[model samples]
Target: MTTPMNNKNSLLVELFVEELPPKALKKLGDAFANEIFGTLRKLDYLEAASAKTTFASPRRLGVHITHVREVCPDIAVRTRLLPLQVAFGPDGEPSPSLLKRLEKEGATLAQTTRAFEQDKEFVFLEKVAAGRSLRDGLEAALHVAIENLPIPKVMSYQLESGCELPGWSSVSFVRPAHGLVALHGDTVVPIEALGLQAGRETHGHRFEAAVDPVVLRDANSYALQLQDEGAVIASFEARRAEIARQLAAAAVKVGGGSVPIHDDALLDEVTALVERPNVLVCSFEREFLEVPQECLILTMKANQKYFPLLDAQARLTNKFLVVSNISPDDASAVIEGNERVVRPRLADAKFFFDQDRRKSLASRVESLGKVVYHNKLGTQGERVQRVMHIARGIAEKLGDAKVAAQATQAAQLAKADLVTDMVGEFPELQGTMGRYYALHDGLDAAVADAIEDHYKPRFAGDELPRNNVGLVVALADKLETLVGMFGIGNLPTGDRDPFALRRHALGVIRMLIEKDLALGLDALLQDAAAQFSAIAGFDSSKATVELRDFILDRLAGSLREQGASAQEVDAVLAPFPQRLGEVPKLLAAVRAFAALPAAAALAAANKRIGNILKKAPEADAHVSELLLKEPAEKALHAAMAEVVPAANAQFDAGDYTASLQTLAALREPVDAFFDGVMVNAEQADLRLNRLGLLMSLHAAMNRVAQLERLAV
Candidate 1:
């Protein structure tokens, strides 16, 4: 250790441990570095322009920080003591209580002063507190950083027999830490953590390091030294980029426009597993290509962490790429070893695929009765029956008998694959395997496609179903989940949606709005709820209402995400439009109408008319031509006669944009009516007629959306 100084210098810290979980390494590395940096900054040990670079590897987590201070500046503090009356006697002299407090605090009466706190006087002590040195500050920061790491699960182990606490030798951490390094400039900071003392040495690349213990000269030389002597890439991002570059180059060397399957999650996990990456090309027997590319690709990527190459037509090739942690003079042995390891995995996939086809999906439907889907919602067989009924109803509403029959068949076989061997080995291939098996059974191509696509739009931005049969089945499947879950009162609260109810609701909304389905949302939900009526004491009314609100909420959010303004969304959605498929048209019409020159005045008048009609609850939209008394009312009635008819016709024809624009023509006459006429007239007949006329104008202006919601 060197003598303490106040000069700014770079800092380096490392925690060497056993292999961390590959999936969680990135998050763990970031959290560890950020926690330390935040604590130091809060303690005033960081300069204004301090920066941090994170390092994560299979065996270590480290950080390099710039412009860190060795010691913080002393701070001035004013501490509140007892009340004035309690701190002193009536003689106006120092009391025994005040003397004891001052002595304990290492202060005298000279440092005491009076201050008012909440209308009561109290004695305050003014003093300057000493700042923390780098060694002390770093120790505290390390303890805090370790305590806050987002470890998926922790392991507890007994430390060596000679730890700091003799007989109390248990140490618990994400992994048992072996070494701790803390450096400031050229000096060791002398901090300790996890039963280890700070040092200027760290090991690198367990198998390929040029030096067993790489000695550090200073904080800035850490990365270069580790690379030159240790044969490791310390930075996570740099290593991932290098791996990606190598993968692309190797793919090109195959000379068939081949490219590695791109997956960020796979890349991240592979990066976490390797300290020094070496990409090599390998191949398997051509006979395995008979299996679906999805099964083969998933097996290679999920089990072996390999990248399956795709040909120019985006078909999986027999060859794949492997990222090995070691590199030797002859890479043939490494390549051959990877090929040997992957062949058995591919064989297993092929075996499962071949065995699953021996029995038809229809024959396996009864097995679903024994497999429980949810305790309250019965088994998989029961759920399939519900989905089949819902799908047939939706198809019938679409007015195509052939489509209704195909959808019913598709829904019946959809959940049958849940009991298949292929799906049991890999749960992600549930719907995918169903489609292949359906095709094998000589089902219609449309029905086969629907068997796979009922689970489409599985996540945000995912594609919708491919055909009409698929769309009908998808809608039925999602509605079954929403109605069943909400009816059982298993609602999502805050951020904990264990059942993925939010995603299901969004899927239903997307199908209705994007596919332009003509079914009313209320009726579809009612049909879904009816399937649950056989259960004892089930109430479909409350669940239907709540489920409708949930779907509408999801629709409003989806519209906003698609670039609709909040005010526009509110205007269209406030009326609770049951035909969700018409929302986009209504929103478009509202947007177009809002852009007109007379739109502002008309919207303001509509809002005023609504408020007036609210007070006169007896008002109706029946206007009487014989009872027009004022010129403004007569002029408004005349404008309605010419424009309202065209607007009503355009609206009925589904030309919503033209209809709203046609209503814009009433703005001039409507403004004159509101400015000159009193809707609440003295005579009962005149007041009722005037209210009726205003009500008619209000009705004509707000057919597409609630124009008053757009009012500023």
Candidate 2:
């Protein structure tokens, strides 16, 4: 494997196997490539800045790394030996322990003793080792690369009689391995992987290949040879781009100026499923369009791996694009075959929709009892009742009887679609099908819209609810989940939130803060807990605190994601403000206050004042005029007397930035008071008076935000 006097060369490694799991293909490819590339780079066989390309097809995973050396460079390594005390005896001559260490290090007495004495603390043996050959490094790299693959599922299969045991030769991998190829430029590296000797040959498209096993010429020619001779596009990303471009072209040829469905996961899955992708236009019966576009699109993408074309307005059309592995002279058969295959899928969706609509959404409410929400939290019917109670209270908080009635209606019918055939077939369409059925049931549009939008902002960056009714019900639904889950002690631990409690909490936070709903988070949680009165083993008082902290923790993360520094968010969130809507304003106030010239000095003074107040005698914000002895104390008192009232008024008027910025005016007097006067004075009256002044200043500075947290 040492090629042409150990010159640098591009390297290639390919492992041909059965089709990989589509979802895990990208990760598996990346992990395998990085593992091999990183180990070689660490050993100095490849540089950090070398160019590498990862290729993942349905049947193969490969990597091509440039600027890889045939032999790694020699390195000097220091090996630690015994401690300093053992290196020398009391007689000051070379100790017997030192001589044994020197023998193991293969060093002379004079040289080893001189080198060891310089450091003396710990004896370190130094040696210049020869670089590794490419064959040896590649063999080790292959072992590591295969072992570290992020395989979603592993299989145990029999190998072809290579093991030491008599009748037991088995290999476990993501898929059954067939061949291994390792090339340094044009040279074949002498190594074995998965019981297969290294070779330049790999199988390509099983049916359409020009040759049985594509013979790769060199590292640089692998992709081109696969494409030209083996009829396969070996690069995953290149094949994906080609499929996308062809889909767009095929949609244009259909004359509707349509666009294929834009789903990244679907695209990635299809890319993993094909070697040579030929996107062809296909169509289903136009009557299938009467089914919900989501149902058709999902069935096409999920089951058939087809891209349903949509018009410019993003409405599904009858036409779709199919990525074919074998590009026949006429793709008519492939197109019709896919069209035939998808017809039954679309028919089933239509059947489910029709069957679901024959009965009203209201009729499905009682069936929710058959569905167990959680063994501890009772059934879905009971959960609906809890959500209904919370929703009604929120609606009443918002307005009169009309809003409350609508909210009640929406919350009651919210989970009814869970029992519908359409939703049962496709669990993802739960809330969506509910909306369609509600509208079909002659319910008000607002009620129908609420059913759909209740699950809004389902994931990050998703849209929020459409209207106030939806907002209230969404808040109630999420609150009920949090409260019930917490009451049952099903709190989320690290990476194990089976109920997605964090998402539910963030959803609730998003609705409350975004809608500026008048309900406080604590009030909402308390009401939700009350609805679970019949539940056993529920401790509402404790659960409510946990719920508040969990939601506020999510809020801090959300705030940080929106560009608020951790310090600013901590300052605003320390008090856990009642109106979460005002949190953004408070953060803005902190940011604005922090930008002020006196803000740092004021924050530090506030921190010092807080410490002083904590240690001093308990006192309210009341000062004795006669007890003010120092000039700085009198000035701070006068400044606080003026600033506190104005700041309090601004806080009451909802100008948090103005409130916090106004307190910046007292920075000079605060600095003077801390520098010139002592709060723990000799006289009791003076000490209490100074403490009172500091308390008043501290309270004023922290009303809008916790200024002490802003202290460096």
Candidate 3:
């Protein structure tokens, strides 16, 4: 609690609680910061030079505010009065009773009376409200903010006994609030109304200095005290730097050499798990290394929250690093305990791996029938059959019969490992486990890799399929899930994606574009819809359309993410066929075309032609060269004829920018024809022929894009 050199206001709130879950701690810290600031803004109490800071540990959540205004700014308020004619007599004199009521209501002297519409008059009343003290505003705001802290699960202590807490407060937070500290410079602000007392004392790490509370004389001193006596590094950046230095030193000491500890998630978790981190290296049995490296590492990380180490070759080492909250007197004992806990888990994994190998990979395919994919979509076995059909179609289109057969076989066994004991225990290892089992059973290497790589991009920013077989199976898997869900009407709504269909759709798009694999999504989806319809008894066409639209939405989002403008995307999609791989090329063309100076003029010319055709009568609109009379029309037709071949050639070579340039050459001729010609001539034959010429221009423009749709 630092003393204010000048008169300034501030707030401090601290919540003491039992141990909080690490995951919930970060969420609560963010929620409290946002809620407090929002409440202050809503009440118009936010003033110049305000700062808010939040700190959280397993046992406590605290927030501090500094340089807040001592009082809110004075605000001007206005009140509108009904027409004076209605309140007063026709002679324009106020009624005696009305004047008395206005005075009683605290109405200020009228600033002016002005004539409004319809012979009505309005009177205005204005006043300036005096500011309130910071303490008064914060006291009211604290009550509202505490109630709004978004603690989904809460409990109540004995404080509200016999009195029903409001539904909002009935829930108790992960930790109960012990007390609050409110400070205005060096002065302690009294806040007894909300069961809190302003205090100058705060605690440090429970293990190192339990009950040794430091009296915070000022805001600056409070921060310094925690650092010196409490051994608490309040800043996240300082803590991270210290952890990295300790980890590097520990890794160097372990003779196996320093391994890149690639654990950003673990780093974040460990940072939140402790205020003062003690990084130590611990080793396990070398015999346990024989177990699958992934299983060992995942078990250590997932169960014990340890960071796995890798050797120079990027192989998993037998050692791990654990970040603890307290520096131990005997560090070796902690290492021994962690090693003991990890051994049993690794032993279980090794056992499951050996037991699963006794059966052939082919035999496990039967177990998929018992695994439900979705309630309405039948079993995993049935979905595999659908994937097999889709994969075969994709393979045939790619002209790779051998790869298609291999993909079909891989899809059949992909989900079979879901029934394995190891995968049941660790859901993240579904495809990885399957690939390992297939290889152990002497399946083809390609088939085994396909099993694993088909699920490559499980989420955004994840890897995509590396082989054609994997690519086909990946497409099939995503298509089935999307089509089946849409058929059953389980589409994702705003903020509610139960099935993660969006990820699947985006994964499919990335596989096609990034890998440059040419596959027609519309055709594949159509086939999938048909298969689902036949098995489930519904109209497949509607499902095909819905699924296509869903995928298109994802494609649009992906394109936008790549920096394509909204209008450019619409321009490309307008003429491009709905093929997964073609979208990337179309987008490229649109981007290139948009950069050309001619593109704007071409778009304007097309829009003019379209507008003219909209007004022309549908009857007698066929182009007949014999009916043409005007030289401007004849010249425009010749110019279009000359550019058509060049435009088509440029488009075929994927040079859309060149094609747009060729199209723009017609713009001048088009303008001249419109300037000199009357499209709706008295001669019906001439009018029809002229209209047909305009229609031809519209069609040519549409070959590149529906320019009207590309309007920015």
Candidate 1 has its poorest 10 consecutive residues by lDDT at 1-10
Query: Which 10-residue window in model 2 sums to the lowest lDDT?
Result: 1-10
What RMSD does model 3 have? Answer: 3.7
Query: What TM-score number comes out for model 3?
Result: 0.90
Estimated TM-score per prediction?
Answer: 0.91, 0.94, 0.90
Q: Name the candidate, 1 or 3, with the larger lDDT value.
A: 1
Error of model 3, residue 341, in angstroms: 1.7
Task: Please rank every candidate by TM-score, starting with the best.
Answer: 2, 1, 3
Q: Which stretches of candidate 1 lie over 4 Å from their true place?
A: 1-8, 81-126, 165-168, 595-601, 668-675
Off by over 4 Å in 2: 1-8, 79-113, 116-126, 161-168
lDDT per residue, candidate 3, 35-120, as tens digits?
76667666677665666766666666666666666677887866655567656787877767557656866764464344455666
Q: Per-residue alpha-carbon lDDT of model 2 for 430-492, expressed as tens digits?
A: 889899999999999988999998887799888998988888888889888888888888888
Worst 10 residues of 3 by lDDT: 162-171
TM-score of candidate 2 relative to the true fold:
0.94
The residue-by-residue lDDT of candidate 1 on 1-712, one tens digit each, is 1212333399999999999999999999999899899989988899998888899999899988888999888989898878999898999988888888999999989998899999999999999998879998999999999999999999998777665443346788999888788999889999878878899899889889999899988888778778878888888998999999999999999979999999999999999999989999999999999999999999999999999999999999999999999989999999999999999999999999999999999999999999999999999999999999999999999999999999999999998889999899999999999999999999999999999999988999999999999999999999999899888888999999998989999999889988888899889999999999986656686569988998898888888988999999999988889888899999999999889998888888888988999999988888788899899999999999999999999999999999999999898888899889888889988899999998888888778899998888
Q: State the C-alpha lDDT per candidate.
A: 0.91, 0.86, 0.74
